[model samples]
Target: MLEKNHILTPEKWVKLHADYLYNYTISRINNHEISKDLVQETFFAALNAMKNFEGKASERTWLIAILKRKIIDYYRKINSIKGKAEVRMNFYDDGEHAGEWIEERVPSSWVSEVEKDIENRELGNALEKCISALPEKYEIVFRMKTIEELETEEICKELDISSSNLWVIIHRARLQLRKCMEDNWFKK
Candidate 1:
């Protein structure tokens, strides 16, 4: 059902949609060069598939759909079993409070204050460091599940693991993060 009402203007895409598309891709991919490549790939794919456009959605929406597939494809390529190697464990250094959160009480909410802002920034940095310290597969699984907010089923499919296996990985990843936070973030 290709309606004549919606026509894609490929020539105007760069001027009109480039920034929006780049922002979308960067937010998900987080690498400047890779995001640019993905955006260009999206445009090329859209151009090649222009004939298949059904005109049910706006041009921007259609472009985003193609971009989403490109992102998923990128993840699938990186997480493929052929290239995967045995991951080494880099758990946080052993200490008395191993695998524990040392906070007396969790703050109910962050107030707008300079001290709070500094603390929040430090906490975020510590957490980011701990995440990167995780083993390769654990880091990838944790990021996809928590940061990207992808559905469990989608993550499992992309990682080519069973649902149960995905959960176990997530659980172990959380434990690793907790231990790291205890050593670095909570201690400070």
Candidate 2:
């Protein structure tokens, strides 16, 4: 049961949405090449799933939903690969003790001092710098869970990661941020 008014042709969709979708994606991803690929992929996926289109939402909304999922999938894939590499790099030679913070990498406590200086504008700037310095995967997860206030289950579902993995990533991200803030803001 298709609605004649809502049925969209591919050419019409491309003409109407191609630039908008590209701009939307590029704004979020900050990459022209990847945004182009994702937009193209979105069109192909929408084309294939046209039969299931319920026509409840606008065509642009439906396509954007698919594109959003594609972007999340891309991030998930990157985090999975980086997670494996992180394990290898951070572990000892025995391989039995992975995911443990090394003695040298252990961060000192700065929470008390940070609390005292919470109103300092420099502290906020330093925090932003630290967050931006994190690897893309960790930064995304940290921002989503901490800054965006997204739930653990929501983050896990969006990133396609396990609960344990999410915890590990968050822990590492926090540690890195703490170390960064201590070095850049607390000491200075």
Candidate 3:
């Protein structure tokens, strides 16, 4: 347990990276078992690749960077199997799977009843409607940045807008969405 420049064993490494792998995979797949397996695979892959690791970043960060690519690869494999339709679940359909992934709901005895009541489809739907109703240009920018997970530079290029325009539209879109959520969704 005490040594200079101790090398981490595989078992020790797995213990360290398990939580991160699980979370990152779940963020992509929303399926726990699959995510767990992917994480296991990621650890082994990282272990094999450790020879090339120059410690440019900490070990945990390196594993996580690997895990992100593995998650992306998982999506690619799932897309190949299921086609693009399943990959692109319509925002209007049942969002139970969507609801399960975000960790917004957790087993808790401590939350107030009022707080519990505020989190539901009524809010999700209202937010969706508000997003749907925005001007097309603004909506495209907001959805690409927030939902589709595009980077700002990519979004600007795709929308043919300046960085400043992107910022303005995103800020306005968020404000409008927030107002809609407050007005139509919040159970006040």
Evaluation by TM-score, superior candidate among 1 and 2: 2
Candidate 2 CA-lDDT value: 0.78
TM-score of 2: 0.66
lDDT of 1 by residue, 1-188 (tens): 75556779999999988889998766555668988998999999999999999888899999988887887787667656543443323433359756454453232343345355456776788878988786656666788889989899887765566888778778768767766766665544
lDDT values of the candidates?
A: 0.74, 0.78, 0.63
lDDT per residue for candidate 2 within 155-176, as digits (tens), equals 7876678999989888878877
lDDT score for candidate 3 against the true structure: 0.63
TM-score per model over all chains: 0.65, 0.66, 0.44
Q: How many clashes in each structure?
A: 0, 0, 0
Residue 135 displacement in candidate 1 (angstroms): 5.5
lDDT of 3 by residue, 1-188 (tens): 74334344567776777887686555445457887887888888987887877655777777877876775565445425532222221233355565242332232233245477656767667777988766544665677788778789975654456899889778767766765555565535
The per-residue C-alpha lDDT of model 1 at residue 25 equals 69
TM-score of 3: 0.44
